[model samples]
Target: MAVTGGRAPNQTDSDGRSELGKALRACRGAFIGVGIMSFMINLLYLNGSLFMLEVYDRVLPSRSVPTLVGLVVLAGGLYVAQGLLELIRSRILVRVGTSLDEALGGRIFESVIRLPLIAGGGGDGLQPLRDLDSVRSFLSGMGPSALFDLPWLPLYLAICFAFHTLLGLAALIGAVILIVITVLTEVLARNPLHEAMGLTVRRNALAAASRRNAEVVVAMGMTGHHTRHWSAVNDDYLAQSRRSSDLIGGLGTAAKVARMMLQSAMLGIGAYLVIHQEATGGIIIAGSILSARALAPVDLAIAHWKSFTAARQSWQRLNKLLMILPRQREVIQLQAPSRQVLVETISLVPPGSQRVVVAEMTFALEAGHGLGIVGPSGSGKSSLARALVGVWQPVRGKVRLDGAALDQWQPDSLGRHIGYLPQDVELFAGSIGQNICRFDPEADSQDIIAAAREAGVHELIVAMANGYDTQIGEGGHILSAGQAQRIALARALYGQPFLIVLDEPNSNLDAEGDEALTRAIRSARERGAVVVVIAHRPVAIEGVDLLLVMKDGRAQTFGPKETILGQILRPPPGPIKIAADGGVAKP
Candidate 1:
């Protein structure tokens, strides 16, 4: 099975857990503090019921202004304290959310960067980040407060029972009915909400892809087709959303109606007790207020049920992603590889794919050697280059650098020693100087200029209006294709990495750029760096002394460049004509 399906290498043996759970656990103290505040707030809520009771029973019969004022003053103070505690609890919860984000933001971003490498570039590529946002937003909302207030419902119910048993029984019945509605809402809304979430992800992915390829769609007159496709996806997403909303909304309205009916029933029961000489008239008003307060949390929870469900699903998805791509373990620091790059019978499959693109092929390149890989389209030259540069892992064999496996060193550490310029070069949104130095804050100006000169693009950069400080738009849109390729070459040559791999380095280059690329390759080999170039163009292989020819995912030839090229250029024992596209034909 492909790893993109979420079956990680250590799925069975490793414990399935996420840093999110750990981060939440770290905020246990804040949650406990919030719970304590909720308890106090609930205790203070009785002030309203008790004050009504005193005004109706004590102050009315006695008609004492002083007693009324005293009760009013005490209740007012308690209400202020309750409000303060509530504010503090809200702030604490917000800080807890912030703290959790701060703790996991870096780790989450690292996972996002590596996700494509492990799972292939599919989907929106922002799902994990969105999940974190959902979790944080839910934490910083009223949902958590409602959850915390739920435990105090029994206290209010017990107080109502102290006033009259009949009123307590009525409140209990109403609570039971509301609880059932809450459970039903959860069960019925789950599937619709889940489907809505999936539709949302798909819709967003489509929108993102369309925006990225707008130029293509417009140039090819495909705008209408893409718009209709997006519309269909949007319709499905909206339908799911409307279904979830209607379900939650209908249940929430029912909950509100049931709550009001229960309050009225409490009043009726209290009035009956008063008529039967079992309670005072004050009990009627007091019981109604108490019952409403008792069920308020459940009602609030139901109102925010959608948010709760979204947060729960987001948490689950994030947890699963983290489990699949756990934190990279700390490896022993190894010396910088210096001697040779050994490709020992490696077989490679693309990420998120089951088809092997490169079969078991083996080769070795010693220091001070430059090897060029030549192959037809779909011949796996690029895949082999990916394996050589540690971008793709071999399933069956090892890629060793000076006898140490690629995994022996940390990724960042290993990256510093390998320079790679892919066929399709993309520069970041930064200045030319920053791009060349790999955004190193402490990068020396001399080193940056040296790399540029080595790639033979220093004069072109200096001739620009901003010299090296010119901002390259996202994906280097500001530069021409040839200019971008040369800058990418400079970036690869930066810091003089020991192993350099360039795939189709001259695909977009002019004669000057091609000469610069060849010079850069020769310079790297002179510095004892092992260089590998994968190319289909003839000029790209001129600087290399060794050659490897690939065909049908297998190495068909490998040896000194002259020997391999001589055999390929030699004529067969058949009459043939050289085609205009540089191919021999038997006609």
Candidate 2:
């Protein structure tokens, strides 16, 4: 009922018991400290009560009223202190929980960062996992309650046993019974619950797919009907949820029965011991009061085992995720023995297609010289640009930077040296200046403003009331697409790479914005950067550099623009012509 119906991937296992173990140890110390301090307060109250009684019964036989007044003060003071210690214990444990979350959640992010390639989902998995409430749910649902409870349980049992070994033994037996009930409930319930979660992922995926094609859904009037199709997924999610609930209900009832037995036994046995010679009325009172303190943690542990299990599963999944090797043939090692870059034969693969969208493609742009790539839509301009930026591996050719294969470049140093702008731009929520600098802490304000001015966004920034400090909403939604793109360009230029690859840098820009981009590219070139722009329009680069026209993944013409315009008019694959008016009617 998962796939053919509705379900998604449900990976499992944990990093280890070590994380849980460490959390438990810290909680045990905290809870123990609370318990110890509370025990002292309780003991002192008990001792003081007995002392008051001795004074009333013997030393102050005629002043029993004064003795009673002294006992009330002692009891009230210690009671308040005990409550305070409990609060302190909880506060201490919350801090530990927060710190432990750093370990648990931090490791998940570390795994994500180390990966060179992400499969299938593009790493959106971090969104749900990184959320603070989700982390809280994960932490509360799994970590502290289990660790803190399990150890405190035995301490509870020992305390109960002190009142009377028989009563203590009875409570211990009940605890064991509750634990068995909980684990057994889990064994029977886990599989179906996992099934429900799988269905939830499918529902989310279907909803995502539906939203992606909203125009199609609306044009076809398929929204309402397709929405029903989507509801089928939700229906399955609910059904699975019911199955999970029923199984858990069965386990919960069993555990409840065991808990009731323990509660009833603690009362019955304490009462029996008090009536017999084994325990006193005060011992019975203490037993009733302390039973909750001891049993609370144990029950908590059982309740959250699924969460602990899931956190463990998340840890293992992330670790395996990080270990994935990139399928790209070029490794980008940056360590190969090579000096100046002079390419021989170069080839590149296009996105989502085999057939080497670029074939036998070769070019050499010297250190100070610049190269600009211009082509029609499917002519592999972006593919060539990606190869330069080391984003993709050439299927059958080589890309060398400074005479070494591009794969040998160390990623950090390579990125620091090579700036790239992919067609799709992404920005985080931050101030305009921060977005321009891309959160480079070391970037001087003057440098950021300078880059912004060069990218033609300085005037735009100044127009806003907050100027550079204006908040750009998430993904820079506060700005127009062209504005966002220019800011992204500014970020790339600010990096000052030796090579800059711009793919459709003007795709979303207006005519004026396009002019700004053209100026930025020329400026980058003037600054001694080897600029390779995958252009859709005429070259605004000042110099007459060479031009390459591609047809069916092969360069059909390679020469200077002044030398090749006629061939471009009647280019191989025939001339890309327009009919009627001028707007690219057809090829």
Candidate 3:
């Protein structure tokens, strides 16, 4: 069986538009408007050179003040029009970028959250978000405007050619040189820029890791060691960035210098033709302006080549990610499950892995009953918990709630009926009340307080300075581990879910916390909810009636809790006993 949110059935969609293309297509009108404006802006650009040519060729010879004044007014009007159109065009482009972001931001974030589950937590988690940022920045920046102006280069060159063949030839040569420089900039900067992008991801990951574990590092005197390692990665990233910058900067400078020299050459050629009586003095200045205008797009393109590359790369990565974890289609909502939780010979593999961690595990728990899963580390207890909560999918069988496969229900609807507290208790950066209600804006205050009471955290929360209004720091760092676990327990119990799976819920808890956890499980059971607790500690199972012991991804024992415990704790003739940590002990 395929994992949920894994590769789509059709990896390649030959007929469908890419997600990015679809987003852009939605804003096709804005892009078309930008194109029209670009055309008008380029057409108005001729006003300047033509005004100079007319003044030099006609007005200057006749010494006509009226003609000169008329030219100035006409040219100024066109310039103003051009500037207005350009401003509008730039604003439209920014809006287009914003629109695209609005359309795809939610989808991309959902993909980001699903990616780790599908890919087994490999690679950088924040990379997709970064890619989206790159794409948005490129679309909103001058890079796109420069690209739009490129088409006008040929028209400007044609005008230069119409002036005189020699002037045309000079302009043509300069354009060719700049185009070559642009190509070289792309070719040379590509690898270094790509390397730098990778280095940036690595550097960011390193810094995030260091910060996430700063307490451990500082307390253990490992800060210097991590710092040195960070320095090495930082140096590599900086070196690649510098190399790319230098290369692009050097080429951009070369393009600028070449365009200037070419403009001057066009003037020199125009002057030579004028002396030979083949062209007028006006042609010299006009040809230089036209040629410069023609090459300006190429220069701008060269300058923005780095951003273009980055945007292109980001687009490719986002495309691949979307393909791997395509948007989930709307599924029919299944009724809330309340009868029983069934694990029917289901085998599970970690996301992005072929190794089965929970193999052919079969067990069933009816409503109002509790099951405690006990096993040593790496025995797949946590994996089973994940599967039960639908965070993972089985490779061999199914997990059904009240006779309906979990996948048959829409994710959010199913989530509403289920509660899961993972081994690592994580809370968002919000007030405790918000976190308890799962950020549901319509959550009732009475229900929130009831959940806290059920989790035995209401008194603890009331004792806090801000009570439910207290803001938990990132990852709930503001609260101690025991406090976070109790709050998390409250979150799980918020809606009186049909199923509750707790993985090592008491690992960070003290005796009082353990009592609170036991009470919460009993309260859930009293409500006819299926409660499954994964724990290595014996005290955690004190309230559970049933037990499932796991070993090497397989169930080794399953029975009433007392029967299983008696079998486990019975003397085996030798001096060995069961240790508290689920290991063998010598007496």
Best by TM-score, which number? 3
lDDT of 1 by residue, 206-283 (tens): 989988888999999999998999999999999999999999999999999999999888888888888899999888
- Distance from true position, residue 443, model 2, in Å? 3.1
Q: What is candidate 1's local distance difference test score?
A: 0.89
- Model 2, 1-587: lDDT tens digits are 11111111122115333433444455566656755654554444344334433453444545657666776777667668756765665566566557656654644454345342323243234433433334345654434545644555676677677767886787777777777777776687667766766676677777877876788999999999988988998999999888777766666667666776666677788678767767655555566556655555556666666565455555444434523431123343444222234454777654344466777877777655555566677887776776777777677768777777766655545676776778888878999889777687787999888888778778978999899899998778788888888888887777566777777677777877777877876776677677766666674443326566767666777767666766668645766778778766555
lDDT of every model, 2 decimals: 0.89, 0.64, 0.90
Error of 1 at 575 (Å): 7.8
Candidate 3 residue 156 C-alpha distance from true site, Å: 1.0
> What value does the lDDT take at residue 118 in candidate 3?
81
TM-score per prediction, in order, is 0.94, 0.71, 0.95
Assess the local accuracy of residue 300 in candidate 1 as a C-alpha lDDT between 0 and 100.
94
Clash count, predicted structure 2: 9
